[model samples]
Target: MALIESQSDAIICINETLMDDELRSILEKLENEKDKEIFGLVCKRWLHLQSTERKKLAARAGPHMLSKMAARFTRLVELDLSQSTSRSFYPGVTDSDLSVIANGFKCLRVLSLHNCKGITDVGMLAIGNGLSLLQSLDVSYCRKLTDKGLSAVAEGCHDLHVLHLAGCRFVTDGSLKSLSKNCRNLEQLGLLGCSNITDIGLISLANGCQQIKFLDISKCSNVGDAGVSSISKASSSCLKTLKLLDCYKIGDESILSLATSCKDLETLIIGGCRDISDMSIKSLASECKKDLKNLRMDWCLNISDSSLSCILDQCRNLESLDIGCCEWVTDAAFQVIGTGEIGLSLKVLKVSNCPKITVTGIAILLDKCNYLEYLDVRSCPHITKGGCDEAGLQFPEYLKVNFTGNVVEPDVFL
Candidate 1:
């Protein structure tokens, strides 16, 4: 008999068809959510089994339904109630909803409340006080959260390792101090757009969380050379990824410190750091060349052809590179990348807004970077639709070219 012939028939026979524990275990191993959803619809027993076995759930529905969610999914290990989409404009998860989650999901290890506008300091306090087993928490873009809430989290969630507070503008040095003092095992921290964080906070964090492996201090205007130097000295051995995007106050001194100290850095983003020049690029190429895989220096106005050449020559393991908006970059840099071993492993390259780049450079790039999958040449005046079409014809079918801001026709071989 067909499995989905009728609801009543399927319900009556589901147990007979899927009776063995081995069969149930095999069905439970299906990882796709859509597959699990289909499996759940087979019968009431299947629905109950699926709900109880589910370890991860992304609740995009309204906050009022969280109680129902708790009643349905009792074994959730990771719960994300973040209203990351436009649905956040309407009232989403609130403090009361968070309280229900904190009380219900005792096994919760990862929780994300990112962009949940209704979530306030009270919600965070509930999460901290209740979810002692929480390890990774992302409350990024929760503009209403303040130091009081963060301090409570630090005090309660001692096992918290990954914390993302990007765009929490009100968080000050005091909050960082509290986090550093309490969350000693914190390994990943993101403080992007927290403008008030300065040398004092960073130093405190570095001194306390020496095991930190990833850090994003992007757009923290108050964090300068002194702060970065302290962090590099403390986390150099363990730090694997560091993003200093738009931190205009930091100059070559900070880069020098990082290049000299952080030997294990695999990913680095200095996007919009206007002060970065060849000096630091050369130092990074010499220091962490083999380890570095992803590098972004978008809008770094000072970088020139020499710096690009140095990077391509030394960083042989690079998988992705972005030097978008660097006006000084020319065809010469592209030539350096396309001709050498640098292009073999490079999968993504973005050179948008560079007026000096042309069709000749791009053609060479397409020829050399056999594995390149994504290329963005937006706003490069010299790169025309015809040139891109020619490159598309020559390159593999998997290549995705971004020709925005260029005079290209609709559906032009994307």
Candidate 2:
């Protein structure tokens, strides 16, 4: 009878412990996605009971699709599970599951869930509200990104340095102001293809982020000369690399401003900007001059023979120059470059689709540019055996030379 009484007492103790657990869940109920996942496995009863709350479990498990990590999820600092190679799409998770993860991962500093099509702004806000200590976030290519997600970023992560929102179609300048004012320490920022971002936001960014080192606003059609000017003036001391590719609205004024202000610029890309002319090109060449190395002005319609020559003369430190599809430049332009008087430091030169230039121009380049590593003079009807022989004879030590056919074809000049 005593043994039976002892067993009854043990059952009572078990029930009491569960009651205590229920009370804890109610009082200090952290909606942590990770914690719920762990709590779900405390016993067989809990495991089955939490099966109904699989969505909650996943939030704690992180954005990663890995199966079960209750022990390790509590100590995580950063989570980046961008693209997956999944064959089966699970049905337990909704767009709201991300919110649970954010709540659970409170101490998280960096988070990258780029291209996660399932998550929405609500999920992002949940993270912003939960993980207030975030320092870096990369939500690039998330098509549903709107002011809701951006507002959360402003509300939470204040010490962010890197923010990449490439391909997020809904981002505009209004949220950008909030981001600039709040994230006072941002450094590397990428807004590639964010067409909605206007000049006002660019100005705000320039004014706010005094320490920006790398900025990519490529394909932002709204960003014009005024935007460029703001960036140039604001990022003078800190800006190092700038990409203005496909910014068709930007013209000579922007180039001029960037050249004059960004003195320490190393790489500058103005690909497909049709309105830039000799004056702007000259300004950049003279300002950064030897300091500039990589430059791409491919398909710039306003570029003329005089400006290209001036660039070659002044920017002697140019390692790569892409003047492809510049119709105004003639074979004479190549003659000056090939003559070896202007492009001594040139390693890669692309004058492709400039039909006016002939073999004579290329031959001169091969002779003069002894340090040439890559040369593209494709589609110039005049290019023949003469230019190839000259390049082969002069720069035999330099490898990776491509002048035989097109820019894509790799030829070993050495």
Candidate 3:
């Protein structure tokens, strides 16, 4: 057999399993002024194929950034095109662009199109039309996506595990109901800012899904306590992490219900629920704090010393706590925390904006909570020089601190 003549660059690429498109972009970037002028004359298929596939290149490439991709990489496993700036940068490829990406990435396992404004139902349909191997999909901030698009995802992507639809306003309860019907294996579901989803949809979620481990319904304004209450009744053993921030419709009853039901929950974020008072959280602490490790009650103004007392006294396993803006909690909040054996597990504490807490308060925490690692005390305006001096007495051998929004760096205690 006669040996084939080849360019030096071509010889190296074949050994590396490199694609033609990726190689071409590098060549174009490296080519000199003279080679570019006469490079098109090198071969027939070379120049003809390059310029003719401009539309396809424009579909998945930045306008200013050179796209070398002529065909999708068949073995492509992960595709992340988050943010509208990158998606829109290429003067986005419309429906045809999506078809190209979808048809090309048939082996794609993870696809993230976070805030890709150019993608419509046309782009989503392309996924159904091609990629069946998708396991994780984040379509958060894709404002143009409608329920029709989500319906397609639910229908086609049955193996999806992680689905983030944050800020996808068009998604209604119907979309969630469909997801509950189809994606039974879903492990992580983030529906933040999905305003149309109410108890009707959430109830469907509980009925259809049994494997849910992480669920975020923050900014789901339509969801009331009744919806959460229903979830609380479900004896699902795997519900561990749940975030309900800005779920304005939920009152104290719903939170109480959830605390009662989700007994195994390790992390619970109920920030911005103005309707919740100490009574609600006290009940939660009483019921779930035994297993609770992380709790964020930030901006929960109604929480006072009694509620903090209940949590600090009962939730001994708490590793993280955010009691920001709960002004009613005075220095006395740490009184129970100083109990050597009871509150010993504290590791992370955020008491930002709690003006009532002074040096005496932090001194109790610094002395008792030996494992404290991360602390955020932004604008507590009350943590004066006296408080800093008290905090200086900390026994934190493995601690990092953020005090009053001023970085003292990670001062490890001996």
Candidate 4:
């Protein structure tokens, strides 16, 4: 009788716990999509609750199938119909499908059609006309989208805050100018791999979108220092993240001007900007390094050990740093980093192709950076496999060290 009573009490306790509103709210706020999906499968009540509470949805289903499912989620705020896998078993989402989505999800603020190769200006037009409240849209790898479709979006979604047009090669300055004029509240804009975008388009965006916070002009070869200068002047205070990767035309003069103005910057990626030297980095460190969390300077050949010193001195809160293929990075730079306050905050470090960084410097770094979670030492010929294995043993279970191609013998000792 006692055991039966105890079992009943246990069941009742679980029921009470599951019914807790606070717990349910916490579960609803989960960042990971997979975890939330799994949580939805607990029971019919959970499934229904999760389905209704979910604001964002990314399903493999096509437009026709999604339209059927859309009716179930009356509160859907975001939708992603992009191909999630490298190879899709079904046909990619199309313009007719976007029309269906436009009809169903009226409350949607964000939509992503990344790699939906079949979608063109017609789909964008449908989206523009239907989703008036849309603030964020990503059409990355939708190579067919041109100024006509983008113009439609600008006219329709006047409240747009974020827009990604990566790999949309056909989009020109006209589309940018149109969006700038219409979507004045734009905060984040990505033009990655949009090679045709020139200074005129950049200037237009800067003049109109004063609230811009995140900007990625990577691979926009025609946009030089003049373009960056214009942008810096307009969105200096609001700008938080900037990516100039493969913008080979950009040099220290433009970078310095940006760094001096945008003091609130948190993440800066200047990979392949060969013209950036220690001067630009030092300037950046002096102005924004305190607040900066992530810095990637991959393949910037001009940046030497002094640049690292400048970073370590003031950029104490930095969480992730990548200086891969910076051949000038030596033991002196690592020595400073190993002993500095960065040791406490740095979680990820990439030093690949830095041949001068020896095992001794790495050992010091390992000893100091207790919170280090990832270390990439690939192509660093000086770091032996035996040394890396020893370091791996020293590191906690959570830390991952990549020492590929350095292995000489399987059983070699340091």
Model number with the top lDDT: 1
lDDT of 3 by residue, 174-274 (tens): 88788889888888988888888899988887777667888889989889977776665653577788889878777789768867677778888888888
Instruction: Mark the regions of model 1 whose C-alpha exceeds 4 Å error after superposition.
Output: 1-50, 60-64, 334-343, 386-397, 406-414
Tens digits of per-residue lDDT for model 4 on 1-414?
011235346533334445547646867679898998887776666777677777878877776687777777767998877775577545688888889888888889999888888889999999999999999999988989999999999999999999999889998999989988999999999999999899899899888889889889898988888888788889998888888888988899777887879888888888889999998899999888768988888899999999888896678888788898999988787666655533558788888899889887788777777778878888898886687677664667877777884423211000
Q: Scored by Cα lDDT, where does model 2 land?
A: 0.72
lDDT of each: 0.84, 0.72, 0.73, 0.83
Ordered from best to worst lDDT, the candidate numbers read 1, 4, 3, 2
- The estimated TM-scores of all candidates read 0.84, 0.73, 0.76, 0.82
Off by over 4 Å in 2: 1-78, 84-97, 104-107, 334-343, 384-414
Candidate 3 local lDDT, residue 137: 87
* Of candidates 3 and 2, the better by lDDT: 3
Please report the candidate that would top TM-score against the real structure.
Answer: 1
Q: Candidate 2 vs candidate 4: which has greater TM-score?
A: 4
Predicted candidate 1 versus true structure: per-residue lDDT over 73-187, tens digit per residue: 8888898877756545566777888898888888889999888767889988998889999999999988999999999899899988999999999999988899889999999
